[model samples]
Target: MNAVSAEPASAAASDLPAVHVVAAALVDADGRVLLAQRPDGKHLAGYWEFPGGKVEPGETPLQALRREIHEEIGVRVASAEPLIRIPWRYAAKRIVLDVYRVRAFDGVPHSCEGQPLKWVPASALDPSEMPEADHPVIHALVLPRHYLITPQPDADEDAFLARLDAALARGVRLVQLRAKASDDAALRRLAPACLSRVRAAGGQLLINSRSDLVDEFDLDGVHVTAAQLAALDARPVGAKRWFAASCHGPADLRRAQALGADFVVLGSVAQTASHPQQIPLGWSEFAALCDEAAVPVYALGGLVRDDLDAALAAGAQGIAGISAFW
Candidate 1:
């Protein structure tokens, strides 16, 4: 703000050391994320966030989380693992926040500075009250991180069901049922059976098109293509199913956000749906798109199970693809 602060700001912003990985934990208990209010005089003070601190040089993010929790909250983080990464730039510097899910931890959390801490349920994680840097991280954490499953054209019902079962056995509880058959009648006829298999497997399904099917059948959701999202309207998400869409750039993401989409699929993060000539957005472009959205953006296109790590590294909610899950 003033000349003194401006000098330090210029210095901090310019030669930021190897982007330090800061670890944070969404400590959920009975559906709430544990939050600690930043004390006055600290960066982003007065804003509420998950308790965490910077990873010191030569230390791992997880180790930093454990030490920070103990130092700031007087509690040891028993265990923590990857949740998401948020690459954000403040007026002073850029930070690559490595978030983790702390499902196992000991002792009650308390702020050393005596600021209040509370467990706010996901349903109650009011956007207006959360710190700006945390908004995308919260969205990504709430999403199911679904695995996309596409049925092969002309594949038998039994074979399809087997794939469905295999996916479920591997702990996949969410899927997108995309069977690109040529005939309209065939796509229509295939819906009921496919929906049946998904429900039987105890997994939720999303149909890429056929809003009519969303009406006729009580499927889990609908995923609109990127084209559809661009010209999107604020239609009733309808009570029967969740509504989502596909997005690539900032425009598509903004449209989906305005349309009140539950989530969105963003893609070609790693050369998916290869046409040889088409190159993927890779990590940088993909992460920026993810940061722009208000809702979760699953990494799609050319993603396989192996790509999930890279996807998270790039700030995606998770990987989504016909090839990724299978």
Candidate 2:
């Protein structure tokens, strides 16, 4: 998967009029999103974009989405939610796109104009073909907001399963089953029940640092450590699942992005008991690294649900935690 590179900063970054726009990822039941190609004579002609148009004055972002989606695609957006707000600058103009996930709508999408349109699978999407402003939108569409890393698995199966159940009930949609003390056979024994519980809750489970286990048990994904991430030149070729990495700095983040990872976790943002000896990346440092990231980053270590606002403000997608999340 060739990732899209961020556009170079233009003179217009500081001087151009910032246009407000609303866009939609019209996702179908097949996990495919609708994309539109710019027609001739328009700015960025031949470039592909999510279907939407400029937001008019006195209209909320949702209102703009409803109106633009209906006009551009001929489908009435019945329900949509905020996905991401990107402040980007093209060579000629600056635009702030408030992108949404169109969860429910009325009418089949037909090209109201002569623009070409296609429904693309999320994984099959080529971000390089999209406008630079939409690079973050692609990340938002593929990655979830919250990431939960499990604590040390107890020897007692019932206690461990109970804890896992509680976390899922509390809305931990994406989880990493990190069982450091367990070996291949032991972890394999735990996998079936864990997989069942996660699937039942409509959640995705990624095994930590164990690509072999992911294949063996048919888990949803694999979360590689920073060291493991650096060692990889290409993405895993076997069963397709959500791939992520633990990144500590720009190099790790870049490598993960280049490897076509779905997302990355960057931290010890606030320090943690797990790595008390390591210096935490303070909010300022976290923000700086996150700004350079191409994928949606989750701030890990010393973060709780309460820190969600701070994390988002610092440019992180959300918070990831072990102790706090459980």
Best by TM-score: 2
lDDT digits (tens) for residues 212-287 of candidate 2: 7777778988889999998998886352577889999888987987787877899889878767899999999998
TM-score of each: 0.67, 0.71
Extract clashing residue pairs from model 2: none
Superposed model 2: Cα runs more than 4 Å off: 1-23, 26-34, 38-48, 52-113, 116-139, 237-239
Off by over 4 Å in 1: 1-25, 28-32, 35-100, 110-139, 180-189, 239-241, 272-274
Candidate 1 Cα deviation (angstroms), residue 56:
15
Q: Write the per-residue lDDT of candidate 1 for residues 140-208, one digit (tens) a residue.
A: 566666666575546466677677777777777777777656367767777777777777777787777
Q: What residue pairs are clashing in model 1?
A: 272-301, 272-302
